[model samples]
Target: MATVNPPRGMRDFLPAEKARRERVLAVIRARYRAHGFDEIETPVMEEYSRLHAGIGGDNEKLAFNVLARGLDADAIRAAADDPAALTDLGLRYDLTVPLARFYASHRGELPGVFRAIQIAPVWRAERPQKGRYRQFVQCDIDIIGDATARAESELIAATLDTLDALGLEGGVVRVNDRRVLDWMLSSFGFAEDERPRVLITIDKLDKIGADGVVRELADRGAATEAVEAFGAFLRRPSSADVPFGEQQIRGALPDGVPDEIVAHLTGIGDAVAAARPGESGIPVVFDPFLVRGMGYYTGTIFELAHPSVGYSLGGGGRYDGMIGRFLGQDVPAVGFSIGFERIVDLLEGEADAVDRAIVLVHDRDVTVAELVAVKADLVAGGARVRLEQRPKNLKPLLERAVADGYTGFAFVAAGSAPADIEVKPLA
Candidate 1:
């Protein structure tokens, strides 16, 4: 027999593990609902054109494309030279793309300001590591048709509240505006077309230190003077020294850069502070160098980080022009996505106690009807019950049950009565 295994970067969640994950998801779902966001689900697969439409940034290169099925040899041969010609669709790399398609298709049916909650798996053909999977769940909340800074503030408040509810309080939300980044790049003499390329390099600042970023930029043809100037601004020794305040940022940028953009960043910081008051420890601060990797973000962008995790827990931002690509008219939007897998990994040690009961039949003659009745009774009393034939040694069976997360057990024999089944606590 051939050995069977799950594909690379995938996992099999046994019952106990699945239950734990579902419990965490429940907390997230309830928190989203409490904040008046309505749930929406999009297809796991989407048209290849939509996935490759330039909105996904670097993630587009990692999409898992699906070739058309039932093509004969000649049909396949015809398109062998161009793989994209044979591919009709691809698994969605993230929820934002599908959400944009969904909103554009259903805008008439949705409210003027649509707040959506989506908890679903997204696929990526990238190398997986601890807490990073090729397939993972993203808990996203998006507000469409809202152009004001209030949309960004509400997303920040709701996302932080959700984290706090999951016992992930005190995390920092590092925020930046795309416009400010654009202005900064322009000030360093980068052209409008060169800004995206420079921003992409800058986005890796957290992963690659200042030296690496400067080297990569120079190798990529960024001017020496421009790279040095940008690096100098980004290499400030402390957050206090970084120009984040309205006055400070205005002084750093060119004269014509909008002052309102500075005010917007300041307002978002105040809103976050007001939403999460003293001792909450959830600091929301402006970082001029915080360039989210996604190219679609139009205005305020933010990322969530925690001391417990080595990477960002989740992040999102305003994409005021994305929906227009599909609908032919612009729709202002802002969103935040929680890294569901990373959050679960962080909370794995604090798993909720399992309340399951396993029934072991000591005698072979325990009838099917009797076993069903006992199981039904336990289940009716809100217990997760499992039935098994008693093994030669009760100790080993009980040990296995305990290890498998069964909290209680019941022993049954040939003449056992359903009413008499007494579940004993394991610990």
Candidate 2:
């Protein structure tokens, strides 16, 4: 027999993994609903064009294209040399793309300000390493046609609250409107066409450090002065520093700046301050350095990451014109996605109520009644139940149960002879 295994960067989500994931998703869904957001689902697979068009820089590199299935040997042989000619569909890269299409197609049916939560699997082809997978889930919330700074502020608050609810600690909601980043880059002499590249490099700031970012900018043909100024902006303290007792660096804005971007930044900062009250430990401050790389973000952009994970958990921003690409009319929108795998990693220790195995001993046909009774009881007591075949020693059975994620093992044996039940704690 040929050995079977999951594809690279994906895993067989055993009972335990499935249970823990579901538990977390349930909480997220409930929280979204509490805030009056309706649940929405998009297809797992989408057309290649729809998935990649203007998603962002570098996102195209991660898309996994799908070829035709159930083809005969001749068809496979004919197309073996060139696969691109084989198919046009691909697994969805993320939920946001389908969402934009959805908004475009169904704007008339949806509410004035459509609020929705999408929890589903997304595929990427990046190198799978620790805590990074090619196939994973993204939990997203999108509100279209609402441009208030409070809407963005509420997203930050919701992100914080969701992480808190999941029992995760030391997470930060780093926020910076794209306009602010654009202004900073423009100040550094980067033109409008080059801003996306600049933003992409800056997005890696947390991982690459200031020196690395300077090198990246230099490699992109940016002037040495531009690199230094950009690094300074990243290192510069926010205007909020004055009221919060942090050192103020370059609090004074330089002359020759666009007033629109400045006003937007100040307004967003005020909203963040209001959302995060005094000394709340999770302070949302203006970091002109905080640049979300996605090209689609038109206004305020934000990211949430675990301090321990050392990578972004998820992010989103206002894309007031994305829907217009498909509908030919602007539909103002802002939204964010939560990387489900990243979140699972952060909360793995605290997510304990997962799959529990119930060992069912089949002594004979009649013994199934006791087994059923025990299974029922266990299920009623908030546990998952399963049947096990009987053979005396019970040692291998216990071992198999443990391997199958039976946190609380229950051995159902033939009874009514004594009605004496023994619950043994497996150590």
Candidate 3:
């Protein structure tokens, strides 16, 4: 006999849990749509070559490739140990890549500056951890064909609003730009080719600390002058005490950050703050070393953070060059993604309704037509109705109903009329 369970790193949600997840998703979908994003879906799998394309950064390594159909032992043996040689398609590791392909496939039908909402699951082949899963949902809202900070600002604003709708407070968007990072590295004498690997190392700064970043870079044979300069910048004295405004943004990085880069960042912050004046202050902060892992991020990058969490709630960035791989020409694009699994864990479960969800506990002898008639009447008149035969022990049955979000119950007999039913609060 073998123990049975869901696949490793995946989960099976009970009815109540499924309802709760759908509730959270509903709020997210509604909020994104309210901000003018139209929903679109893409296939879960894409061509292996497209998934293997360089744009996915390190995640391409984790893709779950499908074996080519009609393969036999002979075909498998003939391929030796190469997996890519056997696969024609792969499950998407993230929504952005498929979205790039989707836009390229349907460009003529879409608006010049299209706003899209994509909420779906993406797969990766990684060891499961407490919060990390092999399959997880990513709720993303993207704007294509917009090159300006306006795209970034809208994303930031909508993300904040969605966070509020989810009852997660103290949400902030940490902002940076790939271009600024490139310029900063160049100013420190780091060669252009060294920057990508260096940026990957720098992304670990939050976990490894300044000293660790320096030591690792030194060990990697990075240019001594560049490593030393970057290390100094990381250890620079506190602008921490200062408010996060243009002044703090200037102080955080070395002097002579190109004015246009500064202005673009400033504009995004200003627009988001203006839209959310009721907050303590601006909800966006500038982080000079905020290197999002996706290599496709061509310009501004950002991560969502809440004061209560040690990790990002979600993140995305401008990937202007991604669509070019399929479309033949580049299209300006930027997106924001919500870490659906992480955010769902952060909040408490909520019932879709309380007293409005009614359970009809009835005698088993009652005719099916009569029972369904009353149930349908209640449903039509604005209530969630469920039919349950009266069990010998009522406690367990009612308890299960309560857990399923029913807050009230009514007793029904063979002749009980819809008008005769008296609903009583279970709580």
Report lDDT per candidate: 0.84, 0.71, 0.90
RMSD of each: 2.8, 4.2, 1.5
TM-score of 3: 0.97
- Could you tell me the lDDT of residue 129 within candidate 3? 98
Model 1 TM: 0.90
Per-residue lDDT over 1-427 for candidate 3, one digit per residue giving the tens place of the 0 to 100 score: 7658988989999887788888899999999999999999999999999999888989999999999998998999988688778999999999999999999989999999999999999999989999999999999999999999899999999999999998887799999999999999999999998898899899899899999999999999999999999888888877555555678778888899888888889999889988998877898888889998888898999999999888999999999999999988999999999999988888765425433899999998789888988999999999999989999999999999988888799999998888989999886
Rank by TM-score, descending?
Answer: 3, 1, 2
Model 3, residue pairs in steric clash: none
Collision pairs in model 2: 357-406, 360-388
- Give me the runs in candidate 2 sitting further than 4 Å from their true place: 1-3, 68-86, 204-216, 223-282, 354-362, 377-383, 402-427
Write down the RMSD of candidate 2 (Cα, Å): 4.2
| lDDT tens digits by residue: candidate 2, 153-220 | 66666766677688875567666667666766788878778777777788787789888988899899
Q: Which is the leading candidate under lDDT? A: 3
Clashes of 1: 0
lDDT of the structure predicted as candidate 2 = 0.71
Kindly give the stretch of ten consecutive residues in candidate 3 with the minimal lDDT sum. Answer: 346-355
Worst 10 residues of 2 by lDDT: 241-250
